[model samples]
Target: MKLALFADGHVGTQIADWLLQHYADDLCLVVTTQENSITEAAKQHDVPAVAFRSEQQVLDFAGTRSIAPDLGILAWWPQLIRQAFLDFPRHGFINTHPSLLPFNRGKHYNFWAIVEKAPFGVTLHMVEQGVDNGDIVAQRQIAYDWEDNGESLFHRAQSTMLDLFRETYPKIRSLQFARTPQDLSKGSFHHSSELEPASQVFLKQTYQAEELLNRLRARTFDEHPSCWFEADGTKYEVRINIRKADS
Candidate 1:
């Protein structure tokens, strides 16, 4: 049961470490966007590692590998995986997504959850042709309060997602998992391009306080680029921290 891992970031490093410790012999390949902890772990274990810069490189590598993987795991992947690469793995790929399916299907799951008042959670699903329009293997709906901001929600999702992968991957490896298709009409999707327009704060435009606050808190992640406003031919980014009033 050879496996391939496509991963990036902190959660990606965690996933890579777990796989290396538990299933080192079974890990056939490691695909990454940059040299990080994931690549370093693969090196220690002697697993084949490649840095993918383009969709074409991924496709070309797929064609050239001598051993085809039985399954692929996508953890915090940065690229848009197409059907061509999907077919390279014998059993296809499964993704550990940060949002509950049928809601916030694309980028910035944490931001969209608060902005749109959508249900937030983590999902482990089969990676299909569409952007996260995959069949669910398992999921957990997270509870969030008004005090939760973009940074908090993002960390929560990453933690929950990693836990989901830990619990679900064994079932997946044994071929005991099920695939439940997502209803596309019920969910919202966003492209990377959508964030700019949504994050723009028109100083002259009137907005309901609730709506404006939602937008502010949604983009409140300190590490990420924040919502912005322009005045006097200058642009300024804004991020707000929310909390319950101190007793």
Candidate 2:
């Protein structure tokens, strides 16, 4: 089956490369949000790359395109596609999301997962009119170690997602797979850029020491902002390096 891939950032490189390698014969219409490794990597593979200046522009480009997509897979695409572009694909759009669906279905999910001390994993789901709320195609639990930080956890998800994709692709191609409906009661909706470090920390959602450390280690990456907390009118951002104590 033909697949259209949308991706950006470093995770995009891993996902795009895996797709190109596994589906060498599959035609992929690559959509990108910026000039990044995903774009460069797609170019290296000789795949057609369409760069959009903004999310709205993405919709416009999809509107102009005559070719219809069988399956659309989003790999770290910074821009959100509207329903029009989403409907272009007969199967709608699928995203390699970082959080477990019907729960952590929003931005900064990893952070929230660690903060909430919930199991972290990947969700390959159909993108609906709502955010990450479509029916779930497949999911896998992401493992973590005592010393694993956000960067490590992210790479773990990347590799895990690739494996899940390979195993689920045939099912998707045959259109024989069933999607589990998400329970709206367990669903969470996080707004974009909702909370910064300086934002007031409501005790209800705040974590203790080790829990906070675990959260910090599991969320912030080299590109995303680092986690920070304040005490006694002084604010301190988490800076976990190669060497650190468990405590």
Candidate 3:
């Protein structure tokens, strides 16, 4: 049950802490990107920690240290892991994605789910070379109301991810799980740049109120760029706050 963890961000840090609490003895290495809370958490737990800018660096470091882990877990890790690294772990690699695969396979999956009206959820899957196009190990659907925006959806997905990991980690540890291949024909993948053009809310274009509302909700991430449109050479970003009317 030796584990190698690669993760980033607040949710990543939380997952790392939980793993340390539950499987401290099995944790072999904690790998993070740059100096973040994940790195700090590893230090707090006194777990061996390292930071790598790319997948190659991780592979190189692990090779140099002769570190061989039974399982590699990726929580909110942004880098693209290749086959070499995937094979480094005895049981291969597992990752938690914000959306159910093979839908919303790329960046900003939470935002894309709302914008595309796709099934919103979280997925734990066996990592392959392709981006999020992997065999599903476990998944859980997240519920959202009209009041939910991109940031809220992200938080919900993050919570679901942790829960899914907790539920599935035991099965994985015992090697008592089945691999479910994703239905490639049933899902869609998008790149980060693909959403940029659609994120613009054109004032001159006649869009339905619902469409505009969905756009605003999808793009409303905290401290991040929101949906915008230019008018009279002036750009304006739009944010939506939705709530049910008083009964």
Candidate with top lDDT is 1
**C-alpha RMSD between model 3 and the true structure:** 1.7
Order of candidate numbers by lDDT, starting with the best: 1, 3, 2
Q: What are the candidates' C-alpha RMSDs?
A: 2.0, 4.2, 1.7
Expressed as tens digits, the lDDT of each residue in 87-182 for candidate 3 is: 888989899899988878889887888877888899999999888988999999887778899999988998888888988888988778889999
Model 3 stretches astray by more than 4 angstroms: 35-37, 40-46
After superposition of all CA atoms, the RMSD between model 2 and the true structure is: 4.2
- Tens digits of lDDT, candidate 1, 1-247: 7888999988998999998999898898899998777888899999988887886776577668676889998989877778877887889998888999979998989889999999999998888888898899999999998899888999999899888888887898787898898988997998878988999999999999989999999999877889999999999999887789989
In order of listing, the candidates' clash counts read 0, 0, 0
Which candidate do you rate higher for lDDT, 1 or 2? 1
Question: What 10-residue stretch in candidate 3 is worst by lDDT?
Answer: 53-62
Candidates in order, TM-scores: namely 0.91, 0.77, 0.93
Each model's lDDT: 0.88, 0.71, 0.85
TM-score of 1: 0.91
Off by over 4 Å in 2: 35-47, 54-66, 145-148, 197-225, 229-235, 240-247
Q: Model 2, range 164-205, lDDT digits (tens) per residue?
A: 877888787667778888887875767657536423344457
User: How would the candidate models be sorted by TM-score, starting from the highest?
Assistant: 3, 1, 2
